[model samples]
Target: MPQTIPKKKVRKPQKVGKAQKGKEEKMQPMPVYEKEKIPFRLRDKVAIITGGDSGIGRAIAIAFAKEGADVVICYEKDDVDAKITASEIEKNGRKYLLIGGDVSRENHCQKIIDRTIKTFGKIDVLINNAAVQTPQDELKKISAQQLTRTFEVNIFSQFYMSKAVEKYLKKGSSIINTTSVTAYRGSGHLLDYSATKGAILAFTRSLSSYFSEKGIRVNAVSPGPIWTPLIPTTFDAEEVATFGSNVPMKRAGQPVEVAYAYVFLASDDAAYITGQVIHPNGGEIVNG
Candidate 1:
């Protein structure tokens, strides 16, 4: 059981920089929150999260561990980030498994599921949160190769991972897919990425209905803009500087902020919710 603690505060930093996690590590007065008290909601549940090395995936992994769920994180590469994430999970007194592979491949997805069950015995929550994006100013600038790659990582992997974990997921288990607000509002530069997010929304709704009788649930989280590795790696210095400023909140959300939605969706609190989406877009009002 997690011990009760006083609520913590996270003050915003005065300056930010590039280099992703390195910048986050140096951000003074970094985001903070109180840990959950005893009798964790996900107490003994096992969860699988792809793209778990950094950013939102990393945040969710830590959140799950805090709730007493063992975590298996799949990352394409980057042992440095994965190692830090593993250490944090261990700090929470939860077992951590790191799988280094490309989730875009069906065979790799199968291996992920097989390994998780082998290590943990059963799967209770599957978070399909891995994705990649490249910005193109014009439609003509997008090549067929880039389009295929984006789909494979962003949406295709969801299909493969879902199929791989479906048999092992028992009743009351939940699957949460990470879609983007761009799917609904559209992005002028992120053409392919937005398209795949739209597909994820439709897929989430369809799968929820398909699994309704099995007592399993499927849902999605759509985020507008959050400070993650993807932002620094995909955009220019100027674009990164002004990231998330246009939102109603006027700031990029921290991964921990968005991670709470996943916790709620995966817990019993959402037992009656499925085929729906939870938006954590910094107060942006988006129509379904």
Candidate 2:
């Protein structure tokens, strides 16, 4: 009888202790919404911000309001969050209109424009900021539905919103799309999200050229890891704990830090600028 060969013993990876896990979870960064001594640069302008209910969008809306612009906030759901943002706008003595709808629909985009026009009379700035992301470890793990939804929300809505508001935008008007650092550097897990952001960067550049003759400026903001609601919800606890740690800054940015870029692009301060992108990405240098 042949002697049975003994299989080599393999050790499983050790699990993190509960105490260490708690310490990691506590490392998550907090989000900041406001800054001191912000100048009123966007005075008398009317702006529309998609996903204005929370995170970076909320910070932008409040920052614009502080800069003396009346804002129209477009959000999908979350009436409570919308109300909170509205309260902040009101605190700054700026008027705010909250319109809830799915921007992925062309018709809804039209309605956003229509409602803003009807209420605010004209649109001076359009911030295409709504986006969704699903992280997959591998390409095969990404589903068709996830890919479609990510594109629809992230890139398609920009096209729809821009088209819907194009005719209304006048000379000196600005359209700012929210891209991401991943658009420049790419993301291993956030494949679909990164692709949509890349598309937005291309769209912003092309649209700027098309609108150049019309005197409407188009630009984009590419942000790195920022402390926002999307962080905790989309990423696992371990990922969230280490979020933004890889950046040169070694910390996640505050929403208000990124909001300043939108304020700059939306104001006449950027009148000579178009087809450009601003990076608020924790000192991550990216070409193009």
Against the true structure, candidate 2 has what lDDT? 0.93
Quantify all predictions' global Cα lDDT against the true fold.
0.93, 0.93
Q: What is candidate 1's lDDT per residue for 113-161, written digit by digit as tens?
A: 9999899899999999999999999999999999999999999999999
The TM-scores of all predictions, comma-separated, are: 0.86, 0.86
Window of ten residues with lowest summed lDDT in model 1 = 29-38
Error of 1 at 183 (Å): 0.7
lDDT of 2 by residue, 224-274 (tens): 999999999999999999999999999999999999899999986787899
- Model 1 lDDT, full chain set: 0.93
List ranges where model 2 is wrong by over 4 Å.
1-39
